[model samples]
Target: MSYETYAELKQLVLPHLQPIGTNYREAISGEQKLVLTLRCLATGSSFASMTVPFHMSNTSIARHVLATCEVLWKVLQPTEMPIPNEDKWKSLAKRFGDLWDYPFAIGSLDGKHVALVNPMNSESLFYNYKGYPSIVLLALSDADSCFTLVDCGQYGRVSDAGVFQASRISQLLDQERLIIPDESFMVSTTEKRIPFQVVGDEAFPLKKNLMKPYAARTLDTIKRIYNYRHCRARRPVECTFGILAKKFEIFQRPMRLQPDRAITVTNACTILHNFIRRRDGHMIDRTSEINYEIRPNNEQGLMNLRPQQGGRNSDEATEIRDLIAAFFNDPRGSVMWQDQNVFRNVLLLED
Candidate 1:
């Protein structure tokens, strides 16, 4: 964004802010604090580089940016939380399938590694799958590119699956509230125990809701389109990661701060990202990312009990499948798009 955009955001946030004192209690003037934050997020520059333009020390810049983030997350939007309850999710599902013309109507999941200067007790968690030191940030975003859920501070070495299972989302799933639709499921090793699956790449194990694309050689247009459409919807999460990496170059560079600081900064960038997106009236770019190759997994997964022997007895499978199919089938119907949109969201979330 340009200077005007940052200035506009500063204007919006300033009124909500608690005034800075005369002394540099947090290492800079109030104006400089906001300026440093804008530079960090809008330009994606490092603290050291940002310090030159503001004429402040790098440590001071980092402190201001972090403190400002605290204010944004805690004060400006005390009620803001990533997890959406059923009613809100149903509403989003409608927009996903209708306004966005995307498929599966579920939030996309992905992990981003924020590089950090190795800290103490980092031996186990900071290692990323890429064979480097980092912290893992797991995010789930909708087709609109807004984050519905965000998880940070896991060590880079932790697998996406591991981070997810240990997250608050996992707790939600355990309560049987995070309903996964049929198309979201993949062929599981064993099943009946935990029926809902989390959609992810092949690196993720096959469970009821976890889905993957068929091989390129075997996929037909419908399957291909389905996969493409699902991916199209999911790109927001990846795009958000890009924006964070691109704008806050610090996220891309290794960090020297504590783990808590890294987590706060990541959340701060997200809150700021939403701020910019809300102003612009959009969340994601239109460019398409089309790679569909599946990754190979070497570790064997533990087996869960399979679906009950009684076929046709489970309505869960049927209901979810229909929900997924509606994305592609309902748009062109003569009954009108809005009606279908309403009917579909109500059906999916009511149960």
Candidate 2:
């Protein structure tokens, strides 16, 4: 929020966070706190660096950043995502490479570990390939790369499958309830209406609502095109992750704070990112002020593989090689997949 914008927001929300402190130091004020946090997020500077510019103590800055994030996170996280219904899953199958549309139409489920400095206890649990200990943030990103669902705080040792199993979404899938709204329909003898489903890597199981891509088969064109198109759309969450890790810089390195608090801050940043993106950063293109994680080298995307799974030999290179081949084959790839809706709804247009 800018200077005037901050003033306006304070007035509108004034009735809400009245300061218990007689002075600014006593209790966290409202807008000032928000302003400080935004500044920290945008600048990605150290607390020591921010203390002078924001005119607050290091401890105070940390408190406000955490407190403001807590409040905003509750308001930002989507309790329910839009589009698709229980009855419509089959109907929408044509839209996703002839695959049955389940609960989530074009969601891509994946886990990313944000590098953090090793903590004191430094359990082996948090260490990942980057050679640093960090927490795991598993998310379900739509084709547009927007994170429709997110789960954080798991130690890095937990795999994507493990994170999903422990998530509320996993529970819903197990119960046969989809995340769609009240208006959607459910069929068969059962009265329960399962909403949409989600897409994931090979690590996840295929139930009523979750779908995973085959890791092998570079020669198969259909699955290859399917994977390519989905990834083109799904890269947004990666883009979002890139922005958070880079601009916030704190995330690029091992976070020294308590793991739980670090998770909170991370989630808070994600929510705020979506909020900002919703306002102005909606497209996964260049509109964002921060974009890290350099583009994959086409000459090397396939041959170059990011090693994972405890230093065991990885076949991701071959899979990625197939992906590049599939990408060039798709007409939709020409559009650059700026919005995920393009892929989710692409099959609809052709049909």
**Count of clashes, each model:** 15, 13
Highest TM-score: give the candidate number.
Answer: 1
For each candidate in turn, the TM-score is 0.67, 0.63
lDDT by candidate, in order shown: 0.57, 0.54
Instruction: Encode model 2's per-residue lDDT on 1-351: one tens digit a residue.
Output: 345544544554445545687644566567677777766666666677888877778897888777776665655564323333544443332233222222224455677886566766866878765567878888765444445667787777777778777876677556546534223222232223222445566676544345455465442545555555445434545665776666565665556577777787888777655554444444423222111121222343222334344432345533433333343344432233333533454553444
lDDT of 1 at 217: 76
lDDT per residue as tens, model 1, 69-150: 7776764343345556655655565455453454234666777778777768767677676776777787777666666677
Indicate which candidate wins on lDDT.
1
lDDT of 1 at 209: 51
